[model samples]
Target: MDMTACNVCGKIFGASSGSVCPSCRKLLNIVYDKARAYLRDHPKERVNAVDLAERIGEDERLVEILMLEGRFENRGEDAEESDDDKKRKQLLQDLQKNLASMPQKQHETGTYGSDRHGARREK
Candidate 1:
């Protein structure tokens, strides 16, 4: 049978429903912090899906998925949660986003943190 390495952990396993294994699949998140920061710091620039994705090293589709799934955008006003749970979720999502903007150690000049990298990245 064919096998693949999980994106999150260096584990050899069969490819499953998710892109990565279950462990790392949870980690496939969006860089909302950077996106939000950019939007705030440069509101006049008008950040959108394309520009935001380019800033990182992911496609617009992938980035969108991250944000929506990450729950960065507040959905329901009536949504209730424990203060601790809310803080933990928010922190985790933010941390994931921040890390998403960073490239792996193997990546050099054209991996992330540059809009150019997105265009140059292999499809």
Candidate 2:
């Protein structure tokens, strides 16, 4: 019999190919199903491992491990950005470029209020 320690619980058990034991694998499958169903119901919602685990009532480490193992697909990388998203990103890039190209103005001492005299300026 091939015996090994479970990755999640560190319990000695008989295993074959994977690092995780059968019990842990079953639990991970349940978590995976819950996460998948949640994502399916809320297609547009974005969640990290912690958030997903909280929402799905699973361990964050388990979620992260699943993600590392490619059980969960990355929507951001796989899906194309919407037209509005693309436009917004492009506009932001343009604004940043314009701002970067413009010359910076240095602030001078005694520029604003009281203009040399003690009296307050009008505008």
Candidate 3:
């Protein structure tokens, strides 16, 4: 029989077509379920693997693996973003709107060199 190390726990076990061992697979499934439920309850909350793992109290690595496997691909098209990100985006949009609504200043011609020296005499 062939032996291989489990991807999650690094435990050596009988080799199979899968990268993770049986025990680790079961644990991963539990984590996956928790992640799914959390995401479902908080649909509007953007989260990456690490944040999701922290919220669900699971290992970050497992969540990352599940993400890589496309388990959470179709939940929504919106990408994960933080509160700061949302704030920054809103600020930019507001700035754009403000700039667009403001009236443009009229340009005025000004003298280039030292005005203190003397004023140019027009012929």
Q: List the global CA lDDT of all models.
A: 0.59, 0.77, 0.80
**Where does candidate 1 stray beyond 4 Å?**
1-27, 70-123
Candidate 2, superposed: residue stretches over 4 Å from native = 1-4, 74-123
When summed lDDT is taken over every stretch of 10 residues in candidate 2, the lowest stretch is 105-114
- What TM-score, computed on C-alpha atoms, does each candidate reach? 0.30, 0.52, 0.54
Candidate 2's TM-score: 0.52
Instruction: Give per-residue lDDT, candidate 1, residue 10.
Output: 62
Tens digit of lDDT per residue, candidate 1, span 1-123? 568885445688887644456655544533554555555466567555777779765566645655655543542222533476578778998999879866664475644547666767855
- Clashing pairs in model 3? none
CA lDDT, candidate 1, residue 62:
48
Best by TM-score: 3
Model 3 per-residue lDDT tens digits across residues 67-119: 88787877533454446657887899999987875643223223443343356
lDDT of 3 at 79: 56
Off by over 4 Å in 3: 1-3, 15-17, 75-123
For residue 12, model 2's alpha carbon misses the true position, in angstroms, by 3.3
